[model samples]
Target chain A: MEHHQSKSFPISHVIGFVVSLVLTFGAAGIALKTNLSFKVIMWIIGSLAVIQAGMQLFMFMHLREGEDGKTNLVNMIYAVFMVIVIVVGSIWVLTSGHAAH
Target chain B: MGIKWDEFFITGDPLILGSQIAILLTMIGAVAAITYLKKWKYLWTEWLTTVDHKKIGIMYIISAVLMFFRGGMDGLLMKAQTARPEMEFLNSQHYNEIFTTHGVIMILFMAMPFLIGLMNVVIPLQIGARDVAFPQLNALSFWLFFSGAMLFNISFVIGGSPDAGWTSYFPLAGKEFSPGIGNNFYAVALQIAGIGTLMTGINFIVTILKMRTKGMTLMKMPMFTWTTFVTSILIVAAFPIFTVALALMTFDRLYGTHFFTVSGGGMDMLWANLFWLWGHPEVYIVALPAFGIFSEVIATFSRKSLFGYKSMVFSILGIALLSMVVWVHHFYTMGSGPAVNSFFSITTMAIAIPTGVKMFNWLFTMRKGRIKITSAMLWALAFVPCFVIGGVTGVMLAMGAADYQYHNTLFLVAHFHYVLIPGVVFAVFAGLYYWWPKMFGFMLNEKIGKWHFWLFVIGFNVTFMPMFFLGLNGAVRRAYTYSAESGFAPLFMLSAIGSIILAAGFAVFCYNIYWSIRYADRNISSDPWDARTLEWSTASPVQFYNFAKLPEVKSLDPFWHMKKKNEGLTLFDSEIEEIHMPSNSWLPIYMGVIFGIAGFLLVFEWHIAAAVAAIGIFAGLIIRSFDYNEGFHVKKDEIHRIENAWRKTEGEVHDHVS
Candidate 1:
């Protein structure tokens, strides 16, 4: 009889981490230096943050390796979709409605 | 340099002053009664300081029951005031306080704690674990919750409870509007309770993840365990957002900061966003466990495996995820536009799919199986139709366009009460009946239990059903009194009548509990209901150390399979090993008391002293953690003696059979 131990991590995680850092700082720098619209800068930074969060999920949290990894990934994506609908939808509606003005 | 007692002790109105005096006397009387009964020592030894999950679970139930009475009193007050149009039993401010406190205490203190407590007692035992992963943390969490409960109740005597709704929607909760200690109490109490909830969540997650015996894989775990796991994850992820929101609100109130104040560049919508961020998941956090309870009870009483076990688990997860998105739907009337409303509306409706899947699974579970109409089973079966109605109406409300007509009306009230009463409260009742025999040695009286169930179901429907029609007729919520000329008098009277019936149901429930304890014959059989879980493999009143030797898990229904395979073999084998358990300590109580004092002081703005008290509490907790009280184990001979006695009883049974 042998004890079964799952493999903990792999090398692709390192690549993901490096890429996340580069994109995060790159987005921050662009936002800081630009005289462009604040909304555009916000969009860029927000996108970067999302990517970084995703990278962390995959690399550090090992979202893709467990027995239920695929299921978990799908769940995470669905959760993200719901989060966007809530957060974004709330701002859009409240701002545009006659009550706010 | 010194404390300003005069400023802190200001009493605004004579009514508030009178209410405070009455509450104080009641508390004093309760303390005196406890002392007179000579139950002080017993309470301390068995309940106050015990870390046994079952005992802790019992304590949680007791707390919820007590809080329910308090919250219910608040509800009755609101009802009496609202029984007629423009009837002036209570002022507008007083009515606001009553309803707000009722909603907050009932949801946060009564329902949540009761569910969590039931889960704490049953989940580990169901999953074949001796205790939770972190036993000390479990004890601490209960105390924190108790302290929070104390703070919430104390507000009645000190000033008033939070006048803002349980949602604590800002601009109103902001300092410019709410200038008293009520909001402070709300913030601090929730912060404390939220921490306990978070810790309990982590503890359960660890218990489920790390403490499962061999072969009890993720999917093989009980439906109750699955629900606990999902609910715990929701707690951990969402409760922190509440903590942050409360902290920011506190800053605004206490420090003249403008986090939520409109004039100070504080965005009120930020509060909405943050509060709902936590609030939406919170509804599911409460409901998911109930969902799990129904799944277990439905299958067991029906004599079947869950119809779709995997789908049930996935649905639990799905609801947990979708809940976070649907928080915005709550505030659709707050002027978020059609596009935003439509998005939230769709996401909210998406929640119905998972919920529908669960309902079908429960129905399918009952399709062909031999159904036993036990009290627990009755609640579960009733919950199906009741919750489905609630669910359908929920979907109706989720349609953004339709919500304009429904927002803040008695219709919204009817919708939630429909879901909450049948959805959460009934499920809790189901769990209580289903697990009562396992937790206690004797069965709860089935006749009385049935009476409780029926009265509650009928009363609940009567009470909330008419509110739907009232809301449709343009009746608003949170009104102290509506005018007779408002054309809502008949509905109000109907609701009032319904409330009285509901109160009668609760009274019957209390009496039933008393009668069951006194009259029900104590059956000492370990598997009294022929339960499938590992919890039933122990003695009727389970030992402090749950299992003498942990049983080997071979299948989903391990105990059932074991009994079916070899009825002669004992559930426990002769491998007696020393069991390590945590020793009881007074530190948890001590820390709870100190923090309780600190919260009281902070609410009253005893700033410097409050900080000192908080530091002292933290220091005591840290010190207690370092002082080890490693538990001594029972000798092998004691274990042998107990085993032999059981074996002897078994031999007598066998002899009789021969």
Candidate 2:
């Protein structure tokens, strides 16, 4: 694992990049191509976003590159938590029950 | 699209006219004094262009104090206007403007910077770092905040103060309702200041994480540094939401986009949701640091280590996490439905658990300890009961069902003041008193400081406490006056009297500064309080390069251990090398001035001039990218000389004390 990371052009980056692209276009395709409900579409997109973000951080951003790697990863996770709480909570409250049009 | 000269100048009110003259005279006086004293070059080189964190902290503090005075005067004016039945000291519009400016300045301009200022000064030394990770960026942060504050302040005389209140909620603050340039200051000035605060947050986080001395692991670090670290995290996470919110506001007002418009497919409640999303954490941004300062002071004066140190750290982190979810309570009455409100209400009340832990930690730290009752200690002591009152009322407001009765009333007003005055303001006073010697090499008078504390705390309670009863009696906020038959006359009169006493307390505090400069002894020891933190290990009024040789940290209370062992007294056991420091540059103030001009122009809808000024801001970035001045160095000999002088004084003071 250590030797593989020291490569000039790692296989992991290529695999990560390809996976990220597939995830992005796949989510878009499911949204535009499918006849899914809004709730299902949102769920798919949100889960895709989380996967892509995690992949990017570890692969592209080198979140595990330094002595502060654990800290950086923890911070990223906490930030993701805040984003999920705020976005999902706001949408849920605003679009349902008494707040609904 | 333009304002005429007569309408632009704020011509009518005599009170505003008086302040206009005062501003003019103060400017002219400052310029004349700088020139007459032949200190223009010195001031420019030392203060304006340099990237020293200590100097920047002093500048932040000075501005916070001045803004405090301005905000306090606004308070006095509002109180005076409502002192009697149907009083006409200020008409309703002017009253609206004053209260709006009061809230904005007190929170954004005053409390935020005051805490940030303390964090900037103390964090480096406490962790044994030479300076912040990015010194030049720190200087830029100070200038940006300064320029933004100036832009907000000038609205009083030039355009007009924002009258839709500091929260700047939508539909009320939209162009349709507030068509004048007044609300524009809110959109532009806060954007500038908010950006600066976000940068400060990032700077301190990197500093604490990367710059601590060897063996000073995360848990070994001081409480103040821990608080700063957490506060910086809060700032990074929370401030971006505000920046986006303000930009949406700017677009809705300036370019006629409908992000928050009443018509045009806009959702007004989106602004409220976003505002509180950022706004709730903004409370902890100021508050967590105050808790840190109180921890340091309480531990020092109590002659005991902070009780439950690990628990204190966890509780602060817990508060930061909880602060984000609880914001919907700010507008429970907006009818987001029982389910939504219940979710928020439970999260809001959950905050009390961690806060209660912290309160118990402070009290337990003092129990059975040899507590010295100094001015700083008094402030910390007073904060306990006072902040508890605030917290209990907050829990009362947290109940979604009961909030319908308390919304938009003086009860809300009283709740915040109880929290802020004790939690933020009193803590700032305690910190200033505690750290004054570290900043200036002299002590504040204990007698005078006590007088400042007593009058302020008593007057603070007298003013805000009655507002709760009045709020329960159906006194709504933002009402300019009350009828005598309605029976709010006497309580308001009492609150007005309390404000006068509070003003007197502030006056005494200022006078103490002047008096101490003249009379306080300069020969005191570095560790006059015999404190346990690494900050007290350095000489008073710390050196520019904070330590010659960074002390080796072995424990949480490294300095106290070193003192007890009677070893490492010189703190220069290691060899000295040439110290590299960042070079002073003109780019920061240049960007601050030019960006402020852009903000001013944008406020008045001068698109052409504003665009031109906006270009000047980018020009600063261009110049900086090309500039090759990395920094200068303090030679080994210079370090030796400075370190020896400090050690000699330390030896003499220890001898004298013994």
Candidate 3:
């Protein structure tokens, strides 16, 4: 089992780090230098953040690399869904037309 | 020092003063007894610093039982105070503190540890693993939790208790309104304990995923193990939310941050939302394991395999997922509107489906099998009907519109107690009864256990059932008293009497332990219940190295299969070699003390002292990181010596029985 991969340099990790950096700085550049509307910039940054997170998980963390990898992947996806439900749901409810404020 | 000596010591309340004295005397007595026995070195080496999961689990169980006693006392105090109209047993302020402590201690200290203790004791053994993946980390988790519980417990006598609700909603918990160190204890203590729980979560997840015996697939694991796996995932995901919430609340209280304040652009509602966000899943974290326990117990006692094993596992996963999305149901009255409420209502009601699936699975598991009416099975049996009442009421409350009527009323109180008491508490009792013979070597007295069970169940229903009617009659909760003319006095008195019965039931359980230890039958075999699962393959009062040679798992109930086929009973058939085991260390207890000192100082706003203690803790961590001791191994001779001694005891028992 150990002989299948001597695991020299982690080229995938290097690529992931570089890609993450590019996406992060790209979003920052758009926020600072571009004349795009706030909404458009927000969308771009959100997409970059999601993509960067995915890279970190799959490439860096090796979340899908073992017998239990599928369970791990499914749990991560469900966790993401829960985060969205909590964060977005809270914001929506608290900022809605019928909020206590 | 920011502390005022006069206010800090909590004087002028006779009830509290009496309790303070009692607590002091008890501590002194305990210390004196331990010293008189001259067991300090033995205790320190064998128990305190031990990293064995079984011993750690026993310690957790002992501590949880003690906390349950403390919390139950707080509850009886509430009952006495509210037994009748115009009761003067407890003033409003004292009532507030008692209720707060009661809620916090019962949920966090008692219920959580009880379940975690059982999991620690059973999960590794159930999976045919020697121990959890990280045994030292497991010990640290227990110590951290113990220290946290201690820190919280000391608040009542030292500086008063948190008078805000256990939920500790801000503006109420803020420094302006609270102006004391009570809520500070809540934030810091739970923060410490929650971190420990999160570590246990990660530890178990890794253990189950990476260290199962050969041929045991995930789907082939027992129902209890499956629930443990899912519950651990829930803990890992949910506890971080609580960690962040507690940190922000601590900042708001200690450092004058506006995170949950009504002013400074802060939204107090965020606290509530974040709280329930973690809080809802936390309910499942406790209940799901209880569900797993019932599944295992029901199948074993019924003399059948667990029904719908695949669906049982999937329903657990389903419940775990649904648990995260239903937080909003807790606050439908917060004016989140029909859209938000409807969404939450649907999700909340949807939980019943998975729960119903579980309920049906248990029923079918026992449908046509030989049902043994043992004390453990009785608790599981009672749980079905009681939990159904709780669950149906839960679905009723899930209606956002209907909850508006039930909100903040005793109806709501009755509803949750229905759910939690039967759902979590009864299951704890069931697991305790079922696993007691495994943890200890003797069975608990059956007649006494039946008495305890019946009184507890009847008293529980008698106490909480009237609250539903009271809620419908517009009686509110958290009130210190009601007028005689309110027509709630009779029911309140009845509930108070029922609580006394419940207390009697708990007393009987304590007596049962004492009685059993002294006089019960002791020649019982390891598998006293003739049950399934790999845990029973080991000796009762399980060996430290669990299995002398690791057993091969071929199915969910490997022990049952082995027993039926007369295979794998003598696990030491393989050549006995040196077995590697983790060494015990004092580092965990030292870290616990360091964290405790830091927390106590911070509670009093002693920044310099706290910083020094915090630095000491970090230094301990750094020292641990550099340490390279990989632990010791038990030689083959030592293994043979222990095995022979065990065999001698077994042979004696066999001769006595024959």
Per-model TM-score versus the true fold: 0.87, 0.93, 0.92
Q: Arrange candidates by lDDT, descending.
A: 2, 3, 1
How far in Å is the alpha carbon of A91 misplaced in model 2?
0.9
lDDT of 1 by residue, B450-559 (tens): 88888888878887888999999998888777767888888788888888888887888788789878987774466655666677666666666777777777777666
B1-658: candidate 3 lDDT, tens digit per residue: 5657886778888877898999989999989999999989999998899999998998998999999899999989999999999999999988999989998898999989999999999999888898899998999899899989999999988977888988999889998889988899999989988888999999999999888888899988989889989999999889999999999999999898898898766788889889999999999998999998999899989989999999999999899989988998988888887888999899999999999999999999999989999999999999999999989999999999999999999998888888888888888888998999889878999999999999999989888998888889989989999999999999998889989988999999999989998998877777878888888877778888988877787877777887777776763535688888889999888888888889988888888888989998899899887676688888888888877766556533223211
**Candidate 3 clashing pairs?**
none
Whole-model lDDT, candidate 3? 0.88
The positional error of residue A20 in candidate 3, measured at the CA in angstroms, is 13
Which CAPRI quality tier does the interface of model 1 achieve? acceptable
Q: Put down candidate 1 lDDT per residue, A1-101, tens digits, no spaces.
A: 02434466557878887888799789979877878798989888888888787778777876766788676877687667756755574566557765467
- Output DockQ, candidate 1: 0.27
User: Which prediction has more favorable TM-score, 1 or 2?
Assistant: 2
Candidate closest to the true structure, highest DockQ: 3
User: Fnat of candidate 3, please?
Assistant: 0.52
Docking class for model 3 is acceptable
